[model samples]
Target chain A: MSFAHFSELLEHIRARRSPRRLAVVAADDPHALEAVLDAVRDGVVEPILIGDAAAIAILLRRLGERPDRFRIEDVADPTAAARRAVALVHVGEVDLLMKGRLETATLMHVVVDRSSRLRTARVMSHLAVLEIPTYHKLLAITDVALNLAPDVEQKHQITLNAVEALAAMGVVRPKVAVMAAAEELNPKHLDSLDAAELKRRSLAGDLPGCLVEGPISYDLAIDREAVTLKRYASPVAGDADLLVVPGLTAGNLLVKALMFSAGAKFAGLVLGAKVPVVMTSRSSTALDKQMSIVLAAAATRELVHG
Target chain B: MSFAHFSELLEHIRARRSPRRLAVVAADDPHALEAVLDAVRDGVVEPILIGDAAAIAILLRRLGERPDRFRIEDVADPTAAARRAVALVHVGEVDLLMKGRLETATLMHVVVDRSSRLRTARVMSHLAVLEIPTYHKLLAITDVALNLAPDVEQKHQITLNAVEALAAMGVVRPKVAVMAAAEELNPKHLDSLDAAELKRRSLAGDLPGCLVEGPISYDLAIDREAVTLKRYASPVAGDADLLVVPGLTAGNLLVKALMFSAGAKFAGLVLGAKVPVVMTSRSSTALDKQMSIVLAAAATRELVHG
Candidate 1:
């Protein structure tokens, strides 16, 4: 079922008649433990914490979390913990993977390992879903933390991934804004050229599931006044839900700018993988981490179990 | 001459005794003409309209304007009208140039011509000043519209250009946030690498007149909580007045996102030219144009004619 507010997703996870099992890799870090503990208490997820059992137990007790109520997977080595998390997902033991204290590259390496069950034909990329108080709809930015330098084909999949995720979250047909310097192809600016090409692909049915318009500047995409005053004509001009940036640099800067300047609330996840992955930034608050888990659970429910 | 509030600049422009000379090229476009007329009525400027005189007369009459009240330079050709606008600025006849019905590149070509007085040793770039109600201080974004692909040296110049303009508007030392994808130098992302180098250059006085920090992602640069929580150290972190982007695409999207999603009011001008220039998009409202005129007048009064 499509969801309107993130709270609706929280409701679904809470009921979890068939709970979405989330495996935490190297779940020894205090912050990571705190987040999962909160999730478990909320009853939105069934946890399979994979790491040093003793350390996790001590940290959980410090936070007043009881161990008898939760599932613990003790793996001494951090790498082994990562391997076990992926192994759980591969064998259909878990529905999602949450990175804990381990480094991202290490966890990602194991998740994408050809021998792992989480491997998929499509490349993995990060997607950030933002909730700005000023915007009427949620703002979706892709490949901000992952897929550093994606080419045209990778970008194509990235767009599809975000659209599907949003569609699964209740957006019937997300208006995709292909961001660029100008709404025309300029050789000196490769992004604009790429934006134009992407629009063509979307229109030609190469990229299904959404409406895409590109080679368009930022203002024309989201501001109805800008579109009307500037005489800009595009169906996706004022009501865009997903913004497909030209590259990681633009996506990263765009998402962070809104959060920092406008006090926007956000949740991020890795998509196009075999399973939904939760990977919040280190700077994210406890609240932010909670929101991300909620987001991942909702996305997983919509995509895999729906 | 520096201003802390946008209203302060507006009041100063409203008080100017000698109205600044404004040359309007191809003065037949409805939106462009409306903005120019509004500026004239506000006494912020005195315009010399150049285009098809008959068409302009009709447009003015339709707007209930006194057709013969202002100077009308009849040029049947739009390209020639654009050239005249630049020529007037070159010859000290006008303080700023505005594009009326013509294309932006046409006016830029004449301004950049070596033979024109509008050409200067310093490179020209675009500067957008935002008066967002939610924030305490005005936010300035540079190199958003022009400079498709700027290198490190060009970015340094962009920083200096923004600082000078903001200083003219009353910021003593504009805290400049050099934005990139990540908060640290990752060898793979060139923007972050360049940001690190730019910061070093600022310390060495190469990018003089501003506090520069980069490889600093958007959130770390503007969000105080994110800064304190993440422990990212830099004066620019929570107190940036200006944001210098790595390229046009990132910068353009940022300004748009803020305006559309955050309800920001903005005014922009072309900097590093011989004179302050108003380069509003053809679709801009009269208020946007009037605000741009006020900004240009104040910057001109302080930077060029002080």
Candidate 2:
């Protein structure tokens, strides 16, 4: 029952009893192919690769894998490939969605179309599970890649989005630390006010599903020594389960820095959608793509796709 | 002369023929005292430690140091101690200023008092020189520890503040990349627009003291390979001397993550308040504090403090 590694989470997914299918939108990307291949090898989920058939075959060969062994939907147009993948999920052909070599917006656009069954009233957010070598546990940074400038209400929804996902990942009663410039509100700081408001909402159950506390700095959120020095008390202090950034820029910069400077391994996916979507960056490594698949698969099973 | 190691910077501060006297405002923190003592031992500065006499004596004794060897001013009241430190700088008792055992706002309040003679039209900001092991050279992150929610005009001031500080430290015509989530303006993302505006202002001579370019992400800002993939064209893309973040939270999180997770050696100082205020966080290592002192001393001779 103790999940020290994501591999353990994968084992949970495999013994999950009901097998889940993942629809890969624009699967022509070599990196994407490698990841799905890795997932297939690990038996995480079954894949329905949707893209140009000839291109997928060429990529599979280059990756030293057989072409005809898997289901390949032949859609030439990239946008059409994305729509087809979304349709697969809608028609119950797949239980999960993924962004492949094609544009993220293209796939996301199709996924969020109100006419499509994938539309969810919840605000979409990005959840990045980062394993920094120095940290004792994984740090979950939210809304970093999605929801550019979330207002107080949007952040409320974003918090709910992350808390639930984190809970589903077995983070019981996740300690949410809303990161701001300082640990106290200075009236002039809108972010601090927003954080304080979110904390109030969490207490009042308006932003339910987590132990939310804020107007806290990253130092207080992660470092127990700083907490002792500052004399700040919060469940998230020195042991944050999820970090709720005020805006996208802060989230993006922090995650990118971890990846670039700290050798932090990242697995991020889009939440608050009808189904969890793997929105890996175009330049993401094969490992990143593979990890995103594992994450998306796990998150989707805990969402509407469940 | 090129400054490679911190020791070289330390030696440069020592060998600079005319070392500027630094006024330490309310020096009492253990970390702060240890740092000032180290700087004094290195002979890079002539320090004027002003604080409560009893506390200072106890602090020095704790550090295996004797308090009476240098000029020590006894101002028991913490508030008055800040005032005395400012007055010392005003009356030419010291050329540079350092903060110890006081909140930044309390010290900054006196430093920018209209009657204090430390205030100017230029806005004050914090600059950090991060010596990350992964990085090939020293990285400057601006407005990281100060200036929350900076607008376009305030950001201009922040940029100017960093440029001036870096220029004083001998980075003539430093490459300044205004970092954002992405390279292009996505109308929804304000940091991108702010970066583009900053670049435009630099092009129009409204912003001087550095080669400014932006709407750039962290990868392209430091890593050369990212530049090739993103196809971004800027000298600062791969070799930025300074990274101007969008706001305080972004800067704080970026630098904190850089220091804590990435193992970056960092030195922080408050700039633009008539003098370079040597300030280090409690989490800042002793080497970081000493580095800040060396930086402050090396920069004091320039247009910064004197």
Q: DockQ for each of the predicted structures, in order? A: 0.61, 0.71
Q: Tell me the spans in candidate 1 whose CA falls farther than 4 Å from its real position.
A: A1-3, A12-16, A41-43, A61-64, A113-117, A167-174, A224-235, A301-306, B1-4, B12-19, B29-34, B37-43, B53-69, B301-306
| lDDT of residue A137 for candidate 2 | 75
TM-score of chain B of 1: 0.90
Chain A TM-score for each candidate, in the given order?
0.91, 0.93
Candidate 2, residues A1-306, lDDT tens digits: the string is 224456666777677655568888888888888899998878777888898889999999998888888899999898888778777766667877888877777888887788776878888888998777777777889989888879998998888888877766666778899988887788878889999999988898887668888898887888787788778877779888789998889999998899888988889998987678888887787787888888777766433434
After superposition, the stretches of candidate 2 with alpha carbons farther than 4 Å from their true spots are: A1-4, A229-231, A302-306, B1-5, B61-66, B302-306
Score candidate 2 by lDDT: 0.81
Q: In model 1 chain A, which range of ten residues has the least summed lDDT?
A: A297-306
Candidate 2 has what TM-score?
A: 0.93
Residue clash pairs of candidate 2: none
Number of the top lDDT candidate:
2
* DockQ (model 1, Cα): 0.61
Report the C-alpha lDDT of model 1 over A1-306, residue by residue, as the tens digit.
344455666676677555568888888888877877777778756789889998888888899977766788889787899888887776778877898888888888887777775767787878788777766656777877788768888888888888877775556778888888778778888777778888899889998889899978777777777788778898999777788887788887778767766667788999988788998767777877877887777667533432
TM-score of chain A of 1: 0.91
